[model samples]
Target: EQKKNITYVLNGTTQIQSYVKQLIDVTKSWNCSDVTYTTVRLEDFFADIKEQALGLVEIYHQKIDWKAEQSDKKVTIAYDPMFRAVMNVIQNAVEHTKENGIIYIDAKEQDGRLTFIVEDSGSGFTKEALLHGTEQFFMDDTSRNGEAHYGMGLFFAKTVAEKYGGGIKLSNSENTGGARVEIFFLSSQETS
Candidate 1:
């Protein structure tokens, strides 16, 4: 019995450490100068984001549905940080949403900015959350509803946006009755 218990404890510890390492690997910080920008088509980029979102939802067993709209008009964005920010938004939606929730992702270019919008059918942000969501280590129980979140997702997204000449906006979507997060990236030329 003593040996069996020891084996079980070791296994559990190993699993926990592995999980933590995986999480760290996903959200590792990047220096702004280390990121290189290259021209890429917007539709393709949105498709990649959609794919990543779907995979995360499935992995976490969030039971959320998603719809993605790809821009028909061709446009290019050169900011590499956009990918990390957009992924964080989608994952945030997945984690906050309850079962059977829906997430909407839309990408478009306007006024020399490429905007990516993610809306989740979850309890929208409280006023406090809206105000401080992007602050590092800021988490409110009312907004996330006791989810296993470290509150770094939005902060990282905000950093990515600010580093690339854009910003992040958080709101409650009137149409979806849920949380809406918009991340904008500067135009290709402005990105560099």
Candidate 2:
């Protein structure tokens, strides 16, 4: 039996609306039934997500620092799932970071793995967040409440990565004192 405080909602309507949309996206990622994997050019994959992320960041008045190495490479991935997973990671950054905050995204292949790193210029992960950030329904909010903080973003990303024999590592970025989330996959070894 809870209700929104009208005063708060009225005062923060725009921010709350943006948040609701993000929550909707998070909810949409819960379905895995139609996920299909395909080998895609690294350049295409990078460009697609970059475009999407940039659009979202613009709405929030934020910035991105992108670096993609070896864009000519190819990798087999469930395009949408992985894309949404990566977006979820980025969106997490976008949501937590304040206005004008910068997110660093890097795509690179090394040691036979393809990795997408997303770092946020937000308060770094809380001790609890670092330990269970990817666990289903785990949120670091002290209140431990709110549909907006369902804590599924990283979990969904982790699930998608694991399906491809990869995983996400969470840590505080030494350069920014922010959260760093790296999702990696075993390279397809396709030299196309």
Quote each prediction's TM-score.
0.76, 0.79
Error of 2 at 174 (Å): 0.2
Q: Rate the local accuracy (lDDT) of all candidates.
A: 0.74, 0.81
What would you estimate as the lDDT of candidate 1?
A: 0.74
Query: What is the C-alpha lDDT profile of model 1 across 71-186, one tens digit per residue?
Result: 54444554455787788888888877877667777777777687888888888899999999988778787656585455677887887787667899999999888899999878
The true-versus-predicted C-alpha distance at residue 132 of model 1, in Å, is 0.5
The per-candidate count of clashes, in order, stands at 0, 0
Tens digit per residue, CA lDDT, model 2, 16-50:
67657656655555566666768888888888989
Choose the strongest candidate by lDDT. 2
